[model samples]
Target: MPLKLYLLPILTLFIMTFSSCSKKDSGSAVKPTEEGLKVSLTNVTEASYTAAAGSTYTFQAAVTSKLPSSGVNITVKAVTDPGGVNIPQNAVAPSTSGAIAITLIGLEPLRTVLVTVVITSTSNPDNTITKTFWITNKAE
Candidate 1:
C-alpha cells in the first residue's frame, strides 16, 4: 500500500474532528438564561439595627419557597467596623431550606458593624442579589 493511503485516512479523521466540534448541534443544548431564582428573607427586614455594647445579637432570616431548594448560597460581607464586632464570612443554604443567620458581637460603643447579604444562585453565580444592613453599638 502507498504511504498516501495512511496519510489520507489521518487527514479525513482530522477534518471530521474539527467539523464535529464546530457544528451547531454537536450535542450542545441552548443554555438557560441567568435570570436567577426568586428569593426573599423574612429576617432582617429593617435596614438598620442597634445593639448595646458588649452584647451579642443574632439576625436570623426566614427564607422558604421564595428561593430554589438547591444550589443556593448566602454570604455576609462586612463593609465597615468588622474589627469592632465578630461576624461570619459565608454560608450555604440547606438544600431543603433557605434559612440564614448572622451573629454580631458588639465591642465598641457608637461603632457600627455594617454588612451586606450577598445571595447568589449557585447554579448561576452571575445572578445575585445584595442587601445592606448595619448594627450600631449603643452607648451607655
Candidate 2:
C-alpha cells in the first residue's frame, strides 16, 4: 500500500478518537424558590348605576402589588362569554407604590362583566401575572 493510504486511515482514527472522547455535561435540576411575588386587587368597586337597554355602564378596578413596586404595569379588560365587550386600548402603570386604577366602558345590561387586571413587570417581561373578578348587571 502507498504511504498516502496509511496516512488517510491514521488521520481518520485520530479524528474519531478525539470526537468520541468529547462529552457534554447535563446540568442539574433547578430547585423551586420559596419566596414569590404576590399581587392583589384592593378596593375594587363599580359605580352604583343601573344599565338600561342600549345603554352603557362603566366598571372600575384597582390593583395593588405586595412585592416590588417598580416596573409594574396594569391593564384592565372586560370580557363576556360571547366576547362582544370592548377592552381598554392602553395599559396603565402604577403612579405610586404599585397602585393603579382602570375603568371599563360599554357594558350591557343583564350580562356578566369579567374584569381582568394583568400585572406585568416592565423590567422583567416574563414575570407577568393576572387576576380576574366579575360584576353582574341586573334589570332596574
- Looking at model 1, the pairs that clash are none
Q: What's the lDDT for candidate 1?
A: 0.61
For candidate 1, write residues 1-140 as lDDT tens digits: 68887998999999999988874756876656654545554444456665545555567655543565345677766544646445544454444356666665533566677767677776667767777767665765
Question: Candidate 2's C-alpha lDDT?
Answer: 0.56
What's model 1's lDDT at 60?
Answer: 63
RMSD of 1: 6.5
**lDDT of candidate 2 over 2-118, digit per residue (tens):** 998799999999999999998777887664332234565544443322233433443333334344435566677777745656644455555445445555555566776666767
Off by over 4 Å in 1: 1-27, 31-45, 49-55, 81-95, 105-107
TM-score of each: 0.56, 0.53
Ten-residue region with minimum lDDT total, candidate 1:
87-96
